[model samples]
Target: MGKKLLNKPLSTRVISLNNSQIKGIKHKKKKSKKGGPIPVKELVPKSSALFFQYNTQLGPPYHILMDTNFINISLKNKLDIFKGLMDCLYAKVNCYITECVMGEIEKLGNKFRIALRIAKDPRFERITCLHKGIYADDCLVNRVQQHKCYIIATCDKDLKRRIRKIAGVPIIGVANHRFTVEGMPDAFGAPKM
Candidate 1:
């Protein structure tokens, strides 16, 4: 059993039919091949109290999944990621970092050592990824496929363009010394039918 929220008494976790938890997934590209949903006991890990705090109907306070470019570009523009995010969107942000993005920062050598420092901030939650050795861009792209409302923060031009292909995805980036958001993601985390 996991800990319950502070305001509410302990209650059974509600199960929603439309949630993105893939029970049996088999990932395959070719017609002859088949794929099944990887068994996931809980899509939102118990440790993530912030993610559990969000409700879709209120419409705001996005959960952000950051890219390495988000760090580099923000620092390059002399902005704190959180501070910049605060300047960009009206809603509060719950920030997260994937393992791959941290890995990328580490691999950048001394020139980018400052980024490694930024990644150490306790404010950002960790989004565990099953696949390793892939770039942060690929992992972030895969995340949007889950139909979750995650505002992606990055300054990579190409990556921004790539993300636009996915519907209902909001993006944040730095422009002229301030953070700017292109659109706001739907907090309900519903994929387009």
Candidate 2:
């Protein structure tokens, strides 16, 4: 038999969690209800988490290009887009409206009166106003190009087509309680790409 290694010793490093840290960690674990650090294999499945991680790390800041029709439909539907926009503003996302579009929304009268009221609201005081000339679709296109905004939200089909043609900017349309983003045209007469 080999000689016993009775003289061997294990090294120790001291560490301790403060009361607040321990409490916070416990609280989080309780609230999450899925005990302790989840094993890598048991956390979000690899494929789904990889896509989410890519978006979190590489997605552009949300910048919504707006028009009168977007505001009108959002108001009519009582959708949360307005609130979402407000949250984006709070988070420093660029939200801009041109003077002509503002005027158009205001002129909508009963058709979009509520949206007009909301636009004048103090809660949205931080939204930026861009003063481009009236009847200047080119100017609007220029703004979209300059900012490289991720999406343009509107409700006017003709205007949506026009914008797509002029700026090549992606458009999100809201109509009759539904909203859809433009994609390349497909065989079913759908807007694709």
Candidate 3:
């Protein structure tokens, strides 16, 4: 056992220590060649269509991205999707459903059969998702970030909260037998409150 222990080399690296290291004090950090500390400029690119947080691209024929829960809530409220959207926004609305959201609804089994039927309606355009997994919220958030032209419709509180953080994107939800929009200016038919 003694000879076996002596045969093994030391695993720890031998680092020569100076007076600063022995005193438990770090040496002065090397400054940049520019002279002072590097200034961090975190520049977030703003969309050209955004005029001081208001999206100018929004107009008649609004494009809305629909989530599974939003469809479920709308059906539960007994509101017609087309008629309700027209009444609320006073515009021709185009509803979009993503493949992930469709997969999520389909996975919910027969309990949400009616929602599945509504999602299959010819009026709603289906958006294909190439990414893996069927997590609708991440897929929706990513799509919204890439294209700022969509107004997300979701009854889920978590989804609503996530959408609110992205500037120039609006959220539509069912309330009081109608659709209420958030993050949109008053001129765009957002709720008064």
Candidate 4:
């Protein structure tokens, strides 16, 4: 077995050191060349152009598409998912729900009764996914492929991996108390916040 730090024998020199000498200490300053604090945009080159500033005068370029798990998470947490998305995206985002997701939510039965109720929100545009299957993840991927401007809100790890494979697509995940963007497209349109 390796020698433990606490069991290690002290050197005679260290033992011989006087209390006065041991007490004195110096604070070393960093010598590396450091740049001054720059603006948020300057620090991240092309970030401003990539994540768009929310402008009410101009229409938003992106829309939010919700997944089953994402909706359930909102219902579970008692959060206004749409309001959170708008706040994070810094623009009013048109929300959409896929037929496949609805099927998945409905299948959860009474356990997800609240989520099912929330899913009936009229504000969310019901999208008929081209891939008519029971797999909600596959349907979401297909719909997103069709709508390049869509920013999908989901908590599924596997779904996130699939989304990253497609370039210029953004995925939103809830972290702590706020929503986070996983991918920033070249066109940019998230918020500085």
Candidate 5:
């Protein structure tokens, strides 16, 4: 025979529910009649560091771009008047030369030599020739507008007018170490400086 068993399995059992068990069951509460709670306004505090960070990424303003007539004067004088202008630019602003202007200078035959001499100088930086389709005058105007603040150093009357109409900034030339802002009269008048 087998050893006596300690516990016997029940074949059938009866179960009953308690009062707490029946009362604990509940239905979810109905949603509010006023749709939902009003949305709250989120507050975002501003920081000075963020303002300065954005300003630093913007960099400095752009420099003036010169035309052929100015380059011719610089070459004729052999005084590096361009360099002097560039020195002024360095102090108060920056200086730029367009490839179209460079090409025009190169076409000046012997005068191109003078331009080349100045090109080697560190003060002058050539503006890349991306929009080669635009004429030199138009290109200069566009650059000025893009920079928002700049003067065109040129003596061409028509070019001066175009620049004024397009850029709204004064076109100036340096003479006797002084800058003269070219007006409508000077646009038609002979080159002063």
Candidate 6:
């Protein structure tokens, strides 16, 4: 008998529910509106300079913040930074490199000497980084967040994604051996992702 009982499946057992067990269990009911229309009060402060998601601060003599990899990618593609920017934007462009980016280039060492030489060029204005750490990506993102006037130049996908979240900032990168910009309405040459 014990052997036969052990051989039987557990699912074959019959179970019954008591009246209290059925009544004690509560069923979830759909929420019903009890009152009239409710007004939602939300306040979001927007900058006065921003007009319809377009930054009025951006114009001719564009200021561009250069990333560490952007320099290497430009060199690899045989693209001249100054000429490429001018050709793409059709305006005077000033390239700014942060101290963290400079440090990152230096840390890359010997093989990137050519890239290092290009980054140190006098034409590329150097911006002092007050924050700690030598992480270039965070430095670039933070700087762009504080100032919407700059156009970020980067080949890194992660950095581009972060910049895309911020409003009114444009991004420029090398594509088809030429520079392409995005996030600006007037930029016709900017390639769509």
Question: How badly does each model clash, as a count of residue pairs?
Answer: 8, 6, 0, 4, 0, 0
RMSD of each: 16.9, 18.8, 16.1, 18.5, 20.5, 16.6
Quote model 5's TM-score.
0.52
Q: Candidate 5: which stretches are off by over 4 Å?
A: 1-62, 77-79, 82-90, 174-178, 182-193
User: If ranked by TM-score, best first, what sequence of candidates would result?
Assistant: 3, 6, 1, 4, 5, 2
TM-score of each: 0.64, 0.48, 0.77, 0.63, 0.52, 0.75
Clashes of 5: 0
What does candidate 2 score on TM? 0.48
What candidate 3 gets wrong by more than 4 Å, as runs, is 1-41, 187-189
TM-score result, candidate 1? 0.64
- Candidate 1: worst-modelled 10 consecutive residues by lDDT: 46-55
Winning model by TM-score: 3
Over 59-115, each residue of candidate 2 has an lDDT whose tens digit, in order, gives: 234456667767777777777665554343333334456666667666767867777
User: Rank order by lDDT, top first?
Assistant: 6, 3, 1, 4, 5, 2
Candidate 5 weakest lDDT stretch, 10 residues: 52-61
The local distance difference test score of model 1 is 0.72
Clashing pairs in 5: none
Tens-digit per-residue lDDT, 14-106, candidate 6: 334655557778877554386545556696566666788898999989999999889999999999999989988989999999999999999
Tens digit of lDDT per residue, candidate 5, span 126-174?
7887884636788887676565455678878898777665424556665
Clashing pairs in 3: none
Instruction: Quote the RMSD, in angstroms, for model 5.
Output: 20.5
Runs off by more than 4 Å, candidate 2:
1-60, 83-94, 122-132, 136-138, 166-168, 183-193
Clashing residue pairs for model 2? 183-191, 183-192, 183-193, 184-192, 184-193, 185-192
TM-score for candidate 6, residues paired by index: 0.75
